[model samples]
Target: MVLCTCFFVPPLQAQESPEVDIGGALRFNYNLSSWKPEQKTRGGDFGYDLFRINANAAYKGIYLNAEYRWYSDGFGGGMLKQGWFGYHFSKNKELQVGLTQVPFGIQQYNSNNWFFNLTYYVGLEDDHDMGIKYIYTGEKTEYQLAFFKNAEELRFGNDSEISHSRYSYDVAGRNKEINQFNGKFIYKFGGNVLQRIGFSAQYGSLYNLDTEESGNHYGLALHYEASYKDWNLKAEAMNIAHNPENAASTPDDTILMAAYGAAYEVAADFNIYTLTLSRNVPVNWGPVSALQFYNDFGYMQKQEDDFEDSYMNVTGVLLTAGNIYTYIDYAAGYNHSWLGGNYIDDFSRGTPNANWEARFNINIGYYF
Candidate 1:
């Protein structure tokens, strides 16, 4: 008994157990551009310096988990950005509450990767409207079931008091967009094999503030991913069906438009890629981006193409990018819409609008 106790005690003293790691970064950015929406509205031209900031916190636990992002851009209103609380059953599965981006369409990708979030990418509105989600991550398959408030009709304010939303709803029929209960589901199978298939759907009508439009709709996204050697083929067929009976006129309709794109890992540090053609859509701010006012703009070649020209060569909006302490969070790179022909949007139409001129951004994160 004494020999056994001594051996076990010595091993225990030499080894350390596992606990959770908790710390987050303060994403900072300083912009010198003309297109930063806030600057545009503030009477500052292309050269006035603008600064933005964001903060995050995480608790990686087995039973509980949460993440929030706060950023500011000087405009577009504050974002309730991402506020969700979940109870984990398995390490990769859980039940969630609060504003959650429904796991739909290329569920593996983040909200930023998609072309348009306004589409039924998730159960609609980037927030929670009496919603719930269930995620099951199996060894060979991953599944998601989400139910949240859908924009049934167009309403103004956040008058969700009747809908059990903790936030106040404004009467937004004429001035805002709202919807009814939106629901979605996605199932992904196959590992890092040669290919994988996934299916997703979103159903609801738009209603905010209060006027429920005459058109009610549902959206379907069929996604697939496969590789032939180093070449990866990723595609999606997204379709939306609208019921004309719900509307007064012909109910401006859209349908069967989807994703077709591919990526080829040319080497370890680079990849050749292309995506389907799509139009541009605008999105407002959230609680997080609002508070941080931060943006991230990567390296740019001074636009001074001519050998003799040198008067602020780069003139366009810049996406002041943020960085983590040890790794470049370039994956979660924030986006900004710059004016001039160098627009990030699919369509470069009317980008150099008004007096908006060329803009650029620089990051001096730690103001020491």
Candidate 2:
């Protein structure tokens, strides 16, 4: 979400203050979800969520950008989400360095749901990497090329869960990218109705702590998006493959062991598909301003034959008024995570005779 709070220096204080752009946002959420069998887990299904601060400035031809985030679960511990500095040679070209988002997938994604899609958790989309990047923007096309040194390896606490890296959420658990290369190209066409087609690719050598071996991770994706009237539609399909070195040598107690138990294989290749549709409606009521309705569906299938597919359906609504925003969503997953089994088509919810696992979630936030 883009939020900005502007400040103007008073005439009396203008001489003592420097002109700079700054803004930040505060977010609080009370979540109600069926996924929580016990309500007390993770702050009792509702609590303060996030606080973020952003600043951007440019002097001469050099520019700097930064963002810091604090999570409620961390007791308000600060995390440098993004910090980068670059030289703006021209309006359409620039080179950036530091910790930033890897430009391999769509920005803002294609979902209105706060949780995003499954690929996000898998580290294929909305993942950031510390790297150096060069970008080129033309009238009808934009291109990005980057070489990332690592795949987000910053840690804080000693606890494994709390100290885990953000960008290494793949199933294999070996997500420490020793080295990586990423590139994406987007081309736009059509006149009245804007249309865009894009391609993205990434390659990384992920380090495994158990065997101390590095695995190869690679993926390719094709996506399309169109905007018309109040409707925004998006679709993407991708193939992600992982090749772990010395898989048989891994001990039976690590994450690799669990991954082996789930897939019954050393290496895995999977195909994932995502589709999203959203519409905006103007509204006039008390504090209510505008409304957005959206639906996001995602499906994943193993490349191997006879492997079942997993899917999730998310439907949500967004309400925006001034700097305040609220989102309410209903999500259902079938044969998808551990809570709902690992495969598909069984219509079983991992339990003996259950159907599917469903949850309702809501988030409220305000920008300052």
Candidate 3:
């Protein structure tokens, strides 16, 4: 998951004296994988993960939010996560321009685990792009409409080589994502037990430089979230399809997706279902104040016959202590990109009857 700082300003305080806040996080990760026998033999690997800087500023009715991150060389070295300028039209309406998060599926996250759900792998969750967005907030409803010109471009012009060293995954290489439109609506039910139901839809074009033609892609999702005291639940179902006009020699069953300095093949059409359940337990154990235990599960059903499906399940706990946060997770997957199968073959033309692989991980971060 793409982790970043978030700022919330009350709607009633739209116009404020010039204010600026800068903060960031430092994180480290350790993991042992079943797929890597060498690593298992040596126990595990622990190393620096990332350092990020976030800035937020507001003057009058205008605001700016930006984040930049630096990761280990193996991951994307350095890149902008998100930067946007927004204007408050009124107490409940705003418009944002520049690189912004795509309003889809769950709002901030669909899963509480550090690995996130499978939707994130396919760019259905926590994806960001260059776009203009309009947001409206009501007492019991919310709406977001956006139009993205294309995915984040490292260099101008279509002839330039696509860079995989970015934060959010998108169609890369010969096929480029362009002219995307998104609309999301949500209704909230307030009571002792809070609940929210939402719908999201997106349509975009895939411009193939080799074929010099544009194919289309679309997605629809239905999501629900509920909270009752310390218990929380989230569920979502989505269908995504990509029809790319590629060179005749290329296969149509898969598309190229790139992120974090790497590109991989993903199934062209699939349906994804995800569910997350969690409970918060409060405690006073020295500096540790609370812990949240969660289980996140996701399944991807491929549309093509004979193609293998993908499965991911994560059981984790989040520990909160002042400025420090930590996650301990046991994650397992079958036909998953980061789990077992070959590096680039897990999501596309996956191994049938693939055995499940597992990983144990710990991530700790300090936020200012």
Tens-place lDDT digits, model 3, residues 96-207: 8999999999978889999989998888878999988888889899989899999888888756657888888898878889999999999999698999999999999999
Weakest 10 consecutive residues, lDDT, candidate 3?
Answer: 1-10
Compared to the true structure, candidate 3 yields what TM-score? Answer: 0.95
Provide backbone clash counts, one per model. Answer: 70, 0, 0
Model 2 lDDT per residue over 1-368, tens place: 00011112111111233335788888777654455656635544666777888888765545678887776443425566678887644566667888777886677565668768866645666565678887778889998888888644455323221234232243334434558888899999988788989999988886665566777878898989999999898899988877666457553222221111232122256778999999999999878889999999988766645445567888999999888998888878765563244332221112233456777778888876
TM-score for all models, in order of appearance: 0.45, 0.79, 0.95
Evaluated at residue 341, the lDDT of candidate 1 is: 32
In terms of TM-score, which candidate is strongest? 3
A best-first ranking of the candidates according to their lDDT comes to 3, 2, 1
Ranking by TM-score: 3, 2, 1
Give lDDT tens digits, candidate 1, residues 183-244.
34444454454566777676655332234443455556566665443344455545534432
Best candidate per lDDT, number?
Answer: 3
| Candidate 2 residue 78 C-alpha distance from true site, Å | 4.1
> What's model 3's lDDT at 24?
100
In model 3, where do residues sit more than 4 Å from their true spots? 1-17
